[model samples]
Target: MTQSLSPLKSFSPDSGQVKVWIRRLVWKMSIATFLLMAIGSATRVMNAGLACPDWPLCYGQFVPTQQMNLQVFLEWFHRLDAALIGMSAIALVGLSVWFRNVLPRWLPWASGFALFLIVFQGILGGLTVTELLRFDIVTAHLGTALFFFVTLLTIGACLSDFQGNNTANKLPWIGLTAASLIYLQSLLGGLVASQWALHQCFFRGDMCIVMNTHIIGVVPAALATLAAIVISWRTAALHPLIRTFANIALVLISSQILIGVATFKLHLQVAPLTVTHQAVGAALLGSLTLLTVFALRDRQSSGQYPASKLT
Candidate 1:
């Protein structure tokens, strides 16, 4: 008689060391992704987008030998940093694929997708500079980075060993709804940044001007996120991972709003804070996307739980 392999043995948990290494790799990639986005935003804030005035190089020099000019240095340094991050991302993809048996299947795909997007984003960045920082291309570049950020977060969550209860399946819908709203808000924020619309409502001579219309859209978005948090918390049937992510989204969204108000009240002169606001928005979007993925995963894994309820 032929022996049949047991399903239980087939789906056994990965070894502790393998899980640890996967987590470490995910963390490294996350940090690199954040740094990449931050540097790109800094380049914009410093108005160094066209300092080098060349694609993939600074003033026809591979290393930018001239360090006396601050703009040229900043622009060149940003490019160098970008190259390093790209290499790191490639390494991450290799690691994920090499350890695919122990790691989640989605992790490798996410890393590969991110790598492709980064290349595309690089092309967009080059076009932005070569075209004198055309608004459309610049905005598209930012959008692409946002996509990569969310993908990285999803991969990180998948690699984690956290498993939610089977009772939490019903809450996946809530998580999906909240994620959709957060994404929409994030896209709107990107539009605002790309269009340079933050100052649209502000008249040069008007002091104590009302920003009601400009800030109105944020209210609904914030409310939807808040509702999701409350639902996740109150629903004892929800998974802890989902609840944790929901709470984080709530906190980040609140902070983002405060930063937005501060940016407006300070007459938008605070470059660092403005960039920070953008970063927080990106982080929130990424976290929510991961939360959605985790919630769905939990629903699928719920079947592994015992059929008898634990009193």
Candidate 2:
């Protein structure tokens, strides 16, 4: 005899409480992911990428001692943060698996993918130090972290209980388009950073080489954002979430463009603005990705299958 599938269980009012707990866990993971990115960025900005001159440890020690220098400390701290975040990711995967029957398959799978990406990211981090920050490895490191951040955001959104009730499905294509462009732009930004081309446009004054290359990627990104906005605005009467995310995309893209210009015009290669610009780019990319995931998810929750899968 064939095994019978389990019957669907009746909805529990306490499901809301469970969802809230999941949302909290997702937020914690998101924060951890963001902190990892910040620490990585800080290490780069501080010129401490090669401080340890080793992989998975600092100066051949699991923990540096008081005799260790500041560079060693920075590098060790970064590793510590990475380890914490990795543990957090493992916890997320465990929770997802435990709740597999209650939660959507997408939730656990997405969390697992993020966990895998974190491991890949850790390897890339080691390679970055081992190769003395080779351009290719560094670029890959940043890009991988960006991917991880986006994955975390997706899981976070999935955990939220805010399922839209609008049966009307529209602009799924636009959301996907926006996500693709944002991801491309994020990769290009990583390339710029990895190449240390931030100063490429310094001498030109009128023409910005680094900014131009970055701007080239932005063209498609902006077009995608615009398309999403137009589509969402037209369908706003049907889905308010669409409208909200559309406006958010417009605002974030505009701010990102401004930050890019400011970073170039001011010749900002260090300190607050440089870090701020980097953070803003990360935020913009993460936000766009989240919007796209949630948009598709809203459709899915409403029993309208999205045109594409996130994976």
Tens digit of per-residue lDDT, candidate 1, span 1-311: 12355664565556556666656766676777777777677777778778887889777888777643766777787777767767877888887787788766777887888889878877887898888877778878788877777776776676666566655555567666766676666656555555556566465433212234346667777777777677778876666667777889988989999998898788667889878977887777766776677777776775343322111
Clashes of each: 0, 0
TM-score of 1: 0.80
lDDT of 2 by residue, 1-311 (tens): 12343233333435555556666776776777777777777777778888887778776789768537766777788889888889888888887787677777777888788889989989988889878899889888888887888777777676665565453265666677777777777767767766667665565453356556777888888888788777767664344655666787788778878887887677666456666767777776666666676667666665433332222
Strongest candidate by lDDT: 2
Lowest lDDT 10-residue stretch of candidate 1: 302-311
Clashing pairs in 2: none
Report, for every candidate in turn, its global Cα lDDT versus the true structure: 0.71, 0.72
Q: Give the lDDT of residue 256 in candidate 2.
A: 79
